[model samples]
Target: MRPKIENITDLRGEISRLRVQRLEQEVELTKVTARLKARLHFPVLVYTKISDFFIELFGDDPEDLNKKKENKDWVTNILRVGLPLALNRFLFPRSGFLMKSVVAMVSQKAAKNVNKDSITGIIDKVTDWIKSSKEKSRKEPRMADYGIPPDSETY
Candidate 1:
């Protein structure tokens, strides 16, 4: 007989693993945040207007940028966790890929939980992650040295 993939215990196990793993990724997240905070210069400690980053990074359309700016919370929350998770995925391809998968599963359920209070919580979490990550890296590095800037041939 074939094994079933729908075990409740397995799902819970995966979620617990993801939460712990996400916490661990907090270290690299700090590095990325320090780079961004230094380069972008957003007035708020947290990078609240994340669409600007996307536009600067990708050369997105002006109308799309404005729309994204209007729906800023959605952008902030998505980028808050998604950016570091993405960078980690790029740097260490074998890591916590399953957490991204799990987030996909729970995200719809999580949408209802996205209230004003929850947005505040997301902002706090992202800001804290950046601050903690920056503290860990004693000295800050330049973005140009990393080749992630305006006139770079590589992305």
Candidate 2:
């Protein structure tokens, strides 16, 4: 009877150990899944890619056309801010006027806030909104309300 009781105790300990191991494995799996999702859903790489495109298009070289400083600033800002904003609107259509109003208020607040950190946060939010919008847009096909442009071939 003593030996039998010892054996049962050992079996119960093993079962408990196995349960702990399984829980650890499950936690690790969750971490891995979360990391992968962060990689896919975040737009840090997308922002860099867009920035590079704009730089390549507008950055000056000795052999390139002489560009004005003000023009360059305008182009840079447009690409940095306007492109993402427009893309967001095109892709994720909330109420057009509502979006406009919110963006306008955010912009005004950012400009007036005068705090670097606040502005940075605001900009980040704007970029995220744009990225999400574009992702939504890419999933849908455009309607053919307007005729295709001349000098262009449709595939």
Candidate 3:
């Protein structure tokens, strides 16, 4: 942020100061940028698109099952409270204090992503998968049993 210019003398002084400052800042920036570029030279950055962040942070898909319709009921309230507790207790019960704190913090953030609809959607997907698997098994026989007759060499 440059200071407001006033008189000619002040302006000239500011210009000289800024010129010196700019060169120093530019050198510093180049050094910092080089270090940053070296540290972040992984191809992960190249693979990621700007839309990925938007999609992850906020569901860009209209038909997203996780949050098609958010109902702010007792379930939602309970989820907000229970999710962090459950995650901390079940997943990271043996973790240290710092790990538990981090889990608690992460779960607290994640709780906002989940709701009644999301749970229902997960349940529905599981049930649908089970049904499809069962149906698939029932519909098709194995290669040996599909139409092949048994060998009778012993007989």
Taken over the whole model, the C-alpha lDDT of each candidate is: 0.67, 0.65, 0.76
Candidate 2 achieves a global lDDT of: 0.65
lDDT of 2 by residue, 1-155 (tens): 22233677888887887799899999999999999989986587787798678668877563443433323443344445654466447754666776775765465434332444555788999999999998987866665666667568868
In candidate 3, what are the lDDT values of residues 42-90, reduced to their tens digit? 6557546654775677756855634534545566667668877898789
Clashing pairs in 2: none
Candidate 3 segments exceeding 4 Å error: 1-71, 94-98, 139-155
- Winner on TM-score between 1 and 2 is 2
Q: Over the stretch 1-155, how does candidate 1's per-residue lDDT look in tens digits?
A: 43344889878887887799898899789989999888777556344566467567888889985775565466456655665556556754665767655654455335434546666888999999999998998776645565466666744
Backbone clash total for model 1 is 1
Compute the lDDT for candidate 1: 0.67
Highest-scoring model, lDDT: 3
The whole-model C-alpha lDDT of candidate 3 against the native structure comes to: 0.76
